[model samples]
Target: MAESTTVDIESQQAELDTYHDEPGDRPVLRARFEHNGSPRYMLYTIKRLGLDHEHGFHLDVQLVSDSLEGGVETVEAKLQEGDADLIDIDYISTARERADGAPIVAIHPYGRTVGGLVTPEDSPIEDLTDLRGRRIGVVRRLDKNWILVRAACRERHGFDPDEEATPVEAGSKVELTRMLRDGEVEGVLQFWPIVPEITETGPYREVLPMAELVQDLSETDRKLPISTFLTSEQYLSENPDAVRGFKGAYRDAVDRLTSDDELWEDIGERLMYEDDPEIVRAVRDGWREMVVADWDAETIDGMDRLFDHLLEVAGADALGVDHVPDDMFRLEV
Candidate 1:
């Protein structure tokens, strides 16, 4: 028999550390969100929110940055495919294609939606009807704000958008926006990265705020879900402790950023690392003014009303889902 060398001992230790036997010691929870500034900042800040998550587990928030390559639906598809524990997206109650028959539900709401219709400065478009027959930009189902535009066009102009409008799909946000800027598309019906908050406001002008448009079209003043955290029924059942820990820390982090402006800016910079500081500042200012830390009663009521509007847009035979998924939200840890 021979004694092992120092390098050999260290190698063995590294191997032993690779996996943990205890659930609390080294569990990793994978949460997914799109590759944009808001979710980006939230994930980055949540990572540094300090202390341990439930059962001593740590969260590994996945940034689905393939918006340009794979398209926006890729992130939601990942969740539907059972590849993640949680997802970051808007809580739009649409019986969307990929989500059919899936028990995917919204767990928490974090921020307001930033989607808007941006058009060229010199464009002649003035109303939703003007977009008819012209090529319009869309990110497919991921652009949750499209329901507003569709409802407006259908009710106000007496035209069916799905049939009347020429929708140009570019898969990714970058491409969708490029088409709009190059005049390849006449209008961009999108939000988040394409919104004026996180992007430059010089070359484009906002034709409609998604919230206002949805309100006008639906003929109701109830608020709609802008952003939310989602998870599956199985994940919640299997990882109750971890889920609670993550949610608790998340709500705490939400409250913290609202109170601490410096922390918000610092985290905002990291969240928008790819953005210009000026743009980030403008976004941060707006974010500070509206970032939601909790889902209250009025908020929940607004969401319920949103479902009603979605039903109106989708119709009985279409995609309107009445509830935000059966008992999906947990108000406390």
Candidate 2:
């Protein structure tokens, strides 16, 4: 099944490559995304509906490898090195990089890209208090989901999970899932996209979604976006129209994805790691609530408040940055 999915992704990449073979007079906006990530669903829609062209640009999509590969060449690396024009990253990481002099700025929000704490259905653990001494698997100690979990635990439960329980860093999402299935960990903080598959197909349950924690910590009545669309400062300054065009294309694609149920059927066959009907339905529904349809000054303020809360509870070291740069967010684009 995995082999077939890989082949399908490769075939899709080949097809997308042909779309911009000529480039013509349109400015080609090069972008990179994880090979099987959720963003591709919207990107596929944009290309299929000719939203990019209609908005005045040519979309050049690059499917990137997920492996750290010694952490040399990544989506962020491509953007910093001027090899690509756009990518999405969690805002905390963006702040850290910006503090260290990376010329990237967030142009738009990508939604609350949170994960959940998953345990086997029959497991005795029912809440954060039950995680006292059990092993929890995470992609990394510094991952945003784990940080949020720690903050929520400390604030609501009166103990830091980092000190009270054992955390096993699995190095990657795939390995984290394997650790849970193999009984290497009692609970795993898994990303949202992979959560439905485990809970739907097996005896697993999400104890809590980190999104709830984000809302509670930020004191917001509505969901706030944790990740954002990013591009180099130079790219935004030089090609302002292209950046705005991509935003229009993105908004249109999101609208179509939200309203068209049949379009999800195509996404399940083409972009998803698993094509199970239940999984597809779960993903489609989740995307509707998680993707930010639009953002205004209030949205940015909500994010700022969320950042302040995380900083206050988690500390600068835990967040990897002491402060958010003044120019970190640019909604003007």
Candidate 3:
């Protein structure tokens, strides 16, 4: 893994050339990600696909310890100006809205699921309605889960998250888990893969899952978009072969993740800090529980709904989904 930094276009092209070992060899693909967050998951998935070796790709995973706000800003700055073959990020909608001219390669889809710190014996908060007047800890106001939770609360629960409950912002997952463990918040609306680790640490309860709640409310299939792989339009135009190769490798990773339980167990142990085997098992189980699909009509519509909610929360102009180019999501096969 190499460090990600600003590079001139020529130098970046030379870096891509390294993926090509011999004359007329396949170009090496370089993917960049902000080290600690969802993008890291994407990087690992690519690795599992064996893309680095298969296509002579280089994975450049950089750890930037900024909170959500700063992280997004850093991502935007890099995509708009930095020199990397590709950049992976969560919240594709936000990235696309900010970097309008970027070429995005949607390697795979990440469905949204929720978990909270609650005891098993506690009354199951099966839906957002049950969360009324309860304090909730969130990673950030703009987090996709927060957006979905707010929508669910408004439409299904008939309660406004802004008006009904107190919201505390935690700097990171560790801080958020601490808030839950110390009884600072009644529940925490977090993505599925993360909840298991938080619960294993203390005597917390399991509430309703975000994915189930969304299905109940919409009466149609939907999953919140968590992340995607993206690059500048220029990069994609210059290195179409590399993009295709990377996409193939990523899809391979998704297949492995979808089918192999042992692989996920290994991933859980490597990614999560909690040593409890139960937690690791729970995380693996949770990953299998959610949907992972390509960007289809239903998924896009779901994203539209999410972006609409985001606009309401941020009081900004609605994101134009029509602007998302047809080639945004790549089917590696």
Candidate that scores best on TM-score: 2
lDDT of 2 by residue, 8-35 (tens): 5697687566555455788888989767
Model 3: worst 10 consecutive residues (lDDT sum): 1-10
Tell me the tens digit of each residue's lDDT in model 3 across 1-333.
122222322333343333333323556455544433443444565554546557544444444432444444345455555545666455435445545554545554555534443433364555566666778887765555565666666665567675677778875555676677777887787656666655566566567566665454445564555565666666667777676666666556656776787766665555544546787677656665553645665666665565455455433322233244455654442
Clashes in model 3: which pairs? 19-28, 35-62, 118-204, 118-205, 119-204, 119-205
Cα distance off (Å), candidate 3, residue 258: 2.5
Total clashes for model 2 = 0
Q: Output the better candidate (1/2) by TM-score.
A: 2
Identify the runs in model 1 with alpha carbons over 4 angstroms from their true place.
1-27, 51-56, 66-72, 93-99, 197-202, 215-223, 296-298, 314-325, 330-333
- Please estimate how well model 2 matches the true structure, expressed as its whole-model Cα lDDT: 0.84
Whichever of 1 and 3 has more lDDT, that candidate is: 1
Number of the top-ranking candidate, with lDDT as the measure: 2
**TM-score for candidate 3, residues paired by index:** 0.71
List TM-score per model, in order. Answer: 0.78, 0.94, 0.71
Native-referenced Cα lDDT, model 1: 0.61
Candidate 1 per-residue C-alpha lDDT over 275-297 given as tens digits, one digit per residue, 9 for 90 to 100: 46566566666666546666776
